[model samples]
Target: MHNQQQRIIASAAQREAAQAARLKIRAGFDRSTAGLAAGMTQVNMISVAKDWAYDFLLYAQRNPQSCPILDVLEQQHYHSILAADADIRTDFPRYRVWQHGEMVDEITDATAIYTAHPELVTFLIGCSFSFETALQDAGIPIRHIEDQHNVPMYLSNIACRPAGRISGNMVVSMRPIAAERISEAVQITAKMPSVHGAPIHIGHPESLGITAIDRPDFGDASRIAADEIPVFWACGVTPQAAIMQSKIPFAISHAPGHMLITDIPDRAWMN
Candidate 1:
């Protein structure tokens, strides 16, 4: 039962506070801590001294989807990473530490690493949440978001390219749909490639070796009614799982569902 510790936090005020902090930073301030106390749990904490943005980029290019690099945050700089106003360490609820392809420990903060070497690079990748609105817009519903829980993600038999030291089978999140609407659902979701694109497979759980729909490799499972057929989509969790397997020398990623909120609007990906 302890495969992964799931943290429950109030995300309502969290989002509102994060948005306010972003706005204040935009208006010119030393930093924005408006959402400092935001109840975010299990955000991946990682930091390393010495310039390593190039290494992160190279790793990303090799493993694009798994590590879809959204924003990279540097110690004192803000741009491709996190904004200068934010602190990389202690932002999330928990942190998983990976060194030399091995998990050393999970902690609450990595400030000590930054204290010694402030030139570390932080990267944020695209999360499956980026496409949830689209799914809702197309008349398809999301169960986890509705339940205010982490979307159920599974590590399937599918394999991703070995980008440097990262490589593993694809991970997918499942959504239940009426058996009749499966085709329409796939067509509608396929348009958004930037956000894990579309459904990788239809209703065959065995084909993907899913085993049980209710028991997932990560996150709590959602209810699937008898009238509903389980639909699966390529999940950002795929990369995280891969990185865990690879045990990169030094790596960091968002804890599942605790994504880095970005300024990129929903419509930005429409084109």
Candidate 2:
């Protein structure tokens, strides 16, 4: 049965996540006392559906920045992947659930949504923070990191290539890179594709068809120094744009800024 196969896939994905969690624990973030991970992957527990697991995987595949999936774990209907000890519907500070291409609710949890929709899929896309390492490595001082505000993200006029029921313009997050080190930042990021890879466009927003640099489509707008030009990148939110355009029956994503932090290290960039 397709459902049975999906269960098997979910089981496999959970085990894979458990293994990564063990490795992550060995690397640092402990799981034993996370308060809820107990008896999750290591024992008799419900395994999330593979469709959900695959959904997260596909989202990660489609959107690398905003939806970066550090790990995925599976339970009867819950998948965390690398986050075996984590809770899918509640770990993030906020969740945005969409119906018919429009936001319906901004909730702190999605347990009810899953309960009602037997086929709803969950995804954990990679965040820009993953690539922030490469930027920092290149000596590009990320201003938002110091300010503690959510990194600024904007919906651009540029369009992302379509992928399976999804397609939309790119959503770019901005970082005020100094004038002197801009090239170094680009050169360093070009090497890491798994983490959004490199800047989609830089220098001027209007050139990219973005007329209001101060008015971002999403996230807060920051001060661009007189000397610094706003640098833009293809954001993970690109896929959300796709979903919006396609107007899928239903969808869900992390609230902008409240990212699912993975234990994966930034230095592992070379990987």
Candidate 3:
């Protein structure tokens, strides 16, 4: 009975923390949410016009590793089932507006976009950030969080399965894990398939067409210690790559590293 009571209290605390983080983000706290709301689930968001919604849905299905669908809001709706009373438009700390496949503006609030295009269908995809707490608990270090930097993501030569008009190379986020802990890191993350599963590649960045380790296509780069090996995982940012490559007419996505803090706890998705 005591343990059960403790579990309930911890669950409530996680929900409260998630809500508080969203409130601050709604109030214009523009920054990366990498280490924020520690034990809560975080998600990557992308909204596309209703016309392209089916195509994007197919794309996500074909590329589950990089685009695991969590909660999808139908056209004209902004609330997500993952978080009660949460408005998708203003909950994220930062947003990206894409026009003709180019990022035109980076804004703190995305209310205007949804207001202008009420026909947009929003998708909240699983993010790797949801599993960082588990990794930390296992004594695995997340260098980006340790250095106060956003996790480094790179565009890879990996081509996702094409669906309708959506097709693009995969984008991967990299973390340096100590050589000895590589197997343990893999085991911990593999249990949370909804949040990217496990490392797709380890050691050789060149195999993925990523020649530059110190430079990244998205987010800030972290240094890899000599004793560590660079580990890569399929990233939720894959949708943005699709938008850019496919030249989608209009789209809105959470800025890389700035995720939506859902009311759900990270353990909810653990296997």
Candidate 4:
């Protein structure tokens, strides 16, 4: 089944209310928030030991395009100035736990883990949701949303500048845009720098070292229509790649497409 043609753009208040309600359920969902909280900022979550927080923060500073830091919550700090009274541990629908550079398990909630490891620091990174909303406003078609699939992501040949123990290849999200509107999409997304501004590469996927566009390293594969070309944007998931590559003793990150919806307005990130 196909999703509606008219994009669903909700007000900030409406999205926040709905997110809060969804999070209140005792059992968490395994759903993607790709088009949810339409006009609000959706940030990615990362938690590392207090000892490793400095390295991760430095890594984000080194790779702003892929790891834009929105808010840094100190040890056991749950409340965010960017998000009003939102619980980091339970807000996101899903979480990935990593130990020794390996994904140990996927869990619905990390509150218990956080309670146990009081020294873990949380970092909320910027996401592409804001730029995505802008593209929809400009009359560009988002194929993944129409087909109800998570945005396609892949690890690229490009390597991020290493910061201490954190370093890895950059990851990107792909969206198929009509060849004619490719430039228009670039201009629209460029306005939101904090949310991965503009396309890093357009057209051939092999140039970015992607062997098969149909087989993505993360998220669902998207169909590239005959008239459309794939547009790649640096993804927030790059940090997860970094975590896995660096093999941090322990770390936590939001599952791809399941972001932490913040109270900040989408417009706040406009360049």
Candidate 5:
């Protein structure tokens, strides 16, 4: 009974935090969602035309580690089942609008694009942030959250399996885990397969074709402590990388580190 009450309280708190964060975002507070809405699930979003939706879906299936899809909103739908009454077009802190694989604009609100292209299909992919609270609860430190910076992400030479017209390399987010706690960190995240589970690589960045540890292709670089080793996880940004490399005629995605804060409790995704 005691544990049940605790869960009820945590669920309510997660809902409150998720709603508040969305409200702030809708009001034009543009920033990374890292460490925001603690204990709630967060997701990355990508919207492509209806005709291109199946290809993207196949790509996600072929690359589950990098693209664990949670919810998909069909053409003309801007609402997601994961978050009640949330507007996908404006809830994310920032969005990248793409044209022929080129990023044309970065905006706080994506309503204009959705309004203009109502036929677009939106996919909500799982984010690593959803499993962060678990790591924190396990007494593991998250360097980017502690430093109040966006998590560093890199484009790797590791190629993703091709699906239809969609094909590109994988993108990965890095976290510096203490050498002693690396096992614990991996175990904590491995249970949440829906949220890019487990470290895809650890220690050597070069193995993944990352040339620099301090400079990243996306988000902010984080400091690696003397006792820590860089741990890499498959990143949802992989789809955006595909959009760029595949030269998708049109697409939109949440900016790296800028994710959709959903009402779902983080515990819901835990194994």
Candidate 6:
């Protein structure tokens, strides 16, 4: 907990708002947030109209591994109770705006949309970054971060159970782990269930219907070394897939990897 607290203090002292805003502005031009804001709890954000809130929450509830709920904010609220003094709209580096299930725009802020429709309900879903710190602490390397690329994510054959109108194939993020360190990665991540928990699949992506290891469906491709096995974890991006499938009238999601760095300590999510 000491280590986690130190990270929170250090990051907060740097003014997360300025960092986030700068990152967002830069991402709008280049589009990547792979290794930013290291050590803090980064959360995936999704927002829908108040009318669809119940169904969306049920969807998250049914898919805990992919859509672990960290906080639920009602219409018109931007501050997160989970992350003290945090602004959900501007704290995130980037955002994707969807209209009728189609991606309409990618922006740095969501204030305009929220202002137009104040009844939007926002959900903060746990992100895998929380566990990545733990894995790094255990001497496990994150290849994407090493190469300064977005973490590779894939759409798997695994289908999430339908919750109302929201249902789709499970999406996963992959990290190349040395054969001998697979168990160590599992043990470290398993302790943080709120942050997507442990790896769902290790080695051989084809078993999960992923045809190419280097050609990922989302994010950047990561190299798999000869001695390394690809470890897959259910990803926060899963909801975006579900949202696309559901084709709801409107929705907002944090651009992949551009997460909300919260004030909540990483240990708070540890079970």
- Per-model clash counts, in order, read 10, 23, 0, 1, 0, 0
Better of 1 and 2 by lDDT: 1
Task: Provide the lDDT at 68 for model 3.
Answer: 91
| Local accuracy of candidate 4 as per-residue lDDT tens digits, 1-271 | 0122423355667666656644642256667778775677788889999999999999999999999888899998988876676888888889999998899999888889889889899999888877877888889979888899888999999999999989999999999999999999999888777888888999988999999999999999999899999999999999999998999999999999887776666766776
> What local lDDT score does residue 8 receive in model 1, on the 0 to 100 scale?
27
Please name the candidate that would achieve the greatest lDDT relative to the true structure.
Answer: 3
Off by over 4 Å in 5: 1-10
Model 6 residue 198 CA deviation (Å) reads 0.9
When sorted by lDDT, best at the front, the candidate numbers are 3, 5, 4, 6, 1, 2
Mind giving the per-residue lDDT tens digits that candidate 2 earns over 1-271? 1112322223454445545554453344422111112122121111123443454355446556434443434333464543445556545545677776777887766667767766654544444565675566566777766555556778877755455555567788888888888888787766655456578888888877778877777666777887787788666666566557767657777666654433334334433
For each candidate, the alpha-carbon lDDT, in order, equals 0.57, 0.56, 0.92, 0.85, 0.91, 0.82
Task: Evaluate candidate 3 by giving its C-alpha RMSD to the native, one decimal.
Answer: 3.6
Estimate, for each residue in 1-271, the C-alpha lDDT of model 3 and write its tens digit: 1112323223777888988999999988989999999988899999999999999999999999999999889988999878887899999999999998999999998888799998899999999997889999999989999999899999999999989998999999999999999999999999988889999999999999999899999999999999999999999999999999999999999999999998877877777
Where model 6 places Cα greater than 4 Å from the true spot, the runs are 1-31
Which scores better on TM-score, 4 or 6?
4
Better of 5 and 6 by TM-score: 5
lDDT of 2: 0.56
Per-residue C-alpha lDDT of model 6 across residues 39-150, encoded as one tens digit per residue:
6667899999999999989988898999998888988988886566667776676789998789999888777878988879999998887887778888889998898888
Q: Give the Å shift of residue 92 in candidate 1.
A: 3.7
Which lDDT tens digits does candidate 5 get at residues 1-271? 1123323224676788889999998998888999998888889999999999999999999999999988999988888878877999999999999999999999988888899998799999999998889999999989999999999999999999999999999999999999999999999999888899899999999989999989999999999999999999999999999999999999999999998898878777776
